[model samples]
Target: MSKRHISLKDLANELKVSISTVSRALKNHPDISPELTLKIQKLAADWNYTPNPLAMGLLRQQTKMIGVIVPDIVTHFYASIISGIEEVAKQHGYYIVIASSNESLQKEIESVENLLKSRVEGFIVCLSQETNKYDHFEKLNSNEIPLVFFDRICESLDVPSVVVDGVEATKKITRHFYENGCKRIAYISGPEHLNISKNRKVGYLEGLKECGLKFDPQFLVTCNLSTKDATRATRQLLTNKILPDAIFGLNDTIAFAAMKEIKNQGLKIPDDIALVGFTDEFHSTVVEPSLTSVTHPTFKMGQEAANLFFKCIRNGKGFSEKIELKADLIIRESTLK
Candidate 1:
């Protein structure tokens, strides 16, 4: 017989013992006799018997595996978050399966479906830029699977989430520009569909009001959160009849692109146009005139999201939890006059 055909049932049949007895013997359970245990262990080793975690999970109705989906894994922000998730998961004796969506909604849906078929106990996800609908996620809720969203989340869902207060964070950054003597602040925002973008815009408006600055429709430009798009937006803003004294990018990548464009136009940092970005990525410090940015606790967000998932698992149902983490502004040469 092929080794591939070897199984617990095969061992039980050969030894003329019940399947449960064979299983218990293999595990060295106290109820199994020492002789039987030794015999089963030897036979299993001889047969090269391998346990199947999926089958075992099905039998117990609990898989010690988790599924994590992020927009992109190459970015340090997401990588840091995944590291935190893995750290906490190891302590809880759970394994994580990671997938990157590359900001594609189709890929994100496919990954979720594949992980579901693999029988992961729970999920931690950050919505893809193109994912405006929540149907795929709703299916998980209907199946009673525990889920937690972080960073980019679907506000329509009642699921637990771990995220920073985007509005407050942006408000602080905007206020910083005003304090630094910026007369008109321009904001390069992301796609309107994203909740983070909307919240940040609100904060930006509030900050302008707080600073007694008028809202200029021309100052707010939307992009697809790409470097090329941000560069173009910056060019458009700089060409405006009324020049902005400061500019804020929705995220670090966009900010970096904008900074490059500003320099390309022979503009001086802080002196001509103060700049700030969200998500204090690694490049924020390395770039010339080091980028001023909002520092997100990405690792802590991941840890908290995983903790919330386990909490939902223990509760045996989907319960609502909203965990708001802190994001602080880091001043640098880019925004300092």
Candidate 2:
């Protein structure tokens, strides 16, 4: 038979005292006699005793857990980010509970509730594409829960955040294409409501603005940018009264999709439409006319976010702190003149 736990009753019985007295003694209550305290300590040390963390948590009001959330688990970027978050979590002796929002507000809310039900100490979140309503998160904010937004944060939320200047990164690449003698440029942006996507659009406008080119909404296309979606968008772009001399994809995935479809449409890359994208992906090198893109330090972002999370836990109140990491431009064959 398994050995039974050494309970408060057992300790009290051994020391000829009540369970309440033994409890107070274990808690370092000053009223307990020093002689009795020493005796209880010695017995506890000898018995290989373990205090129940759950019971301790009941007194302190915490479960000592942290939660991290992202939009997609399959994306290499988020996976790298999560790896960084986990690395920092390990250093602080905190366990992380991760969930995927899958770009849906409903799923995001469900995940939040699930983590809260499990008594997570705090939240590190990436907003979902469908989340125009911030009420759910606002409720947590009002209750004074520690919430940090990473990557996809709502500017209005006023919460601690870690992010990059997506607008500036996109502007740099877009200007590079414009300077290379590309007259008509096409933009393939992500889902419309996403903050990252909006930032990229601002960059696109700024790029055009600096080039003294008129901003035509027709030049921009909003789509999921899958290969099939790119094929259709490519056809639509080509069927226009004017064809683009270059294309700016929000990320490498969109760039790859457009690259293949544009080539199939009988246009030589660079010679026809030079391509530039955001987020330097691994596949950029493997693809023909290797994509030039805005480089994001996903790993560092995650590591830093996790590091800050520990500070929040330690501080308890988790004062609002925002950390912005730098992004670099990776020039490659796709955007070379």
Candidate 3:
């Protein structure tokens, strides 16, 4: 007869260590010394051992895994969010399976399907740029699986969501610029399909109206958050007869590009024109004068999404609970005026 597959417990006994210790060593838990972990890992490999992903999935009907899909993994905001989710998952004795949408609806759908096929317990995602259709989300909902939308969420899906108050956050930042002796403030926002972008655009106009500043269509520029688009948008602003006194961006990446171009054009930050950005994130503080942006609670948002997912997973009828987190404005060198 064929010998039975060796288990972690069997390895632990052979190594004269407790099962818990072996498990921790295998996972490379911080408490385990690196030398000991290396020894344990060698033993497991010598045994031709394999981590039973399918058996684990069967145990939880869940793969003991959660899927996290984001618009782009390169952004600091999303990276922070994933870190938080990983922490929360670890606390719950679960692991994360992350994927990047790269702003493609097809990719998002394919990723979701793959995770589902693997029996991931739940999903947390930020929709892609081309995800205007609600059918994919509807399909997720219909599967009797848990789906939590975070950050760039859909407006149509009545599912649980985590996002900052875009309209109010933009209003606060734009109003601050208006009060600081800056009129003709330009708005550099993201793709128009994004709900957050639309909300912030509306708030920018509202801020101008609130400060008795007339809204100018010429001051509004939408870009794809790329270097080329950002450069072209900045050039468009320079070509205009009416120069903006300040500019507010939808996110830090676009803001950084625009800031670079503005400086190259002999413009000074908070001097020639003040600037504000959303997502007070990485490189914001490292930049020359630093960037003043709406500090989004990405980590907390991720935790909330995980918590909501667990609730749904445990409670059959409570999956529809919606959550909205508010954005905070972080004062820095860029908007000190």
Query: Number of clashing residue pairs in every model?
Result: 0, 0, 1
Report the number of the highest-TM-score candidate: 1
RMSD for all candidates, in order, please.
Answer: 11.4, 12.7, 12.6
Off by over 4 Å in 3: 1-60
Model 1, position 336: C-alpha lDDT score:
87
CA shift at 306, candidate 3, in angstroms? 0.5
Ranking by lDDT: 1, 3, 2
Error of 2 at 249 (Å): 1.6
Candidate 1 regions off by >4 Å?
Answer: 1-60
Residues 252-325, model 3: lDDT tens digits: 87788888888999988888878887898789989988998899888898888888877777875345777778
Q: What would the per-residue lDDT of candidate 2 be over residues 124-229, giving only the tens digit for each residue?
A: 8888767888876875665556788888887788778899888788778767887888868789887777788898899889888888778766778877646677
lDDT (0-100) at residue 259 of candidate 2?
Answer: 87
- How close is every model to the real structure, measured as TM-score? 0.82, 0.77, 0.79
Worst 10 residues of 2 by lDDT: 50-59
Instruction: Tell me how candidate 2 scores on lDDT.
Output: 0.78
Clashing pairs in 2: none
Model 3 / residue 256 / CA error / Å: 0.3
TM-score of 3: 0.79
Q: Over the full model, what C-alpha lDDT does candidate 3 score relative to the true structure?
A: 0.81
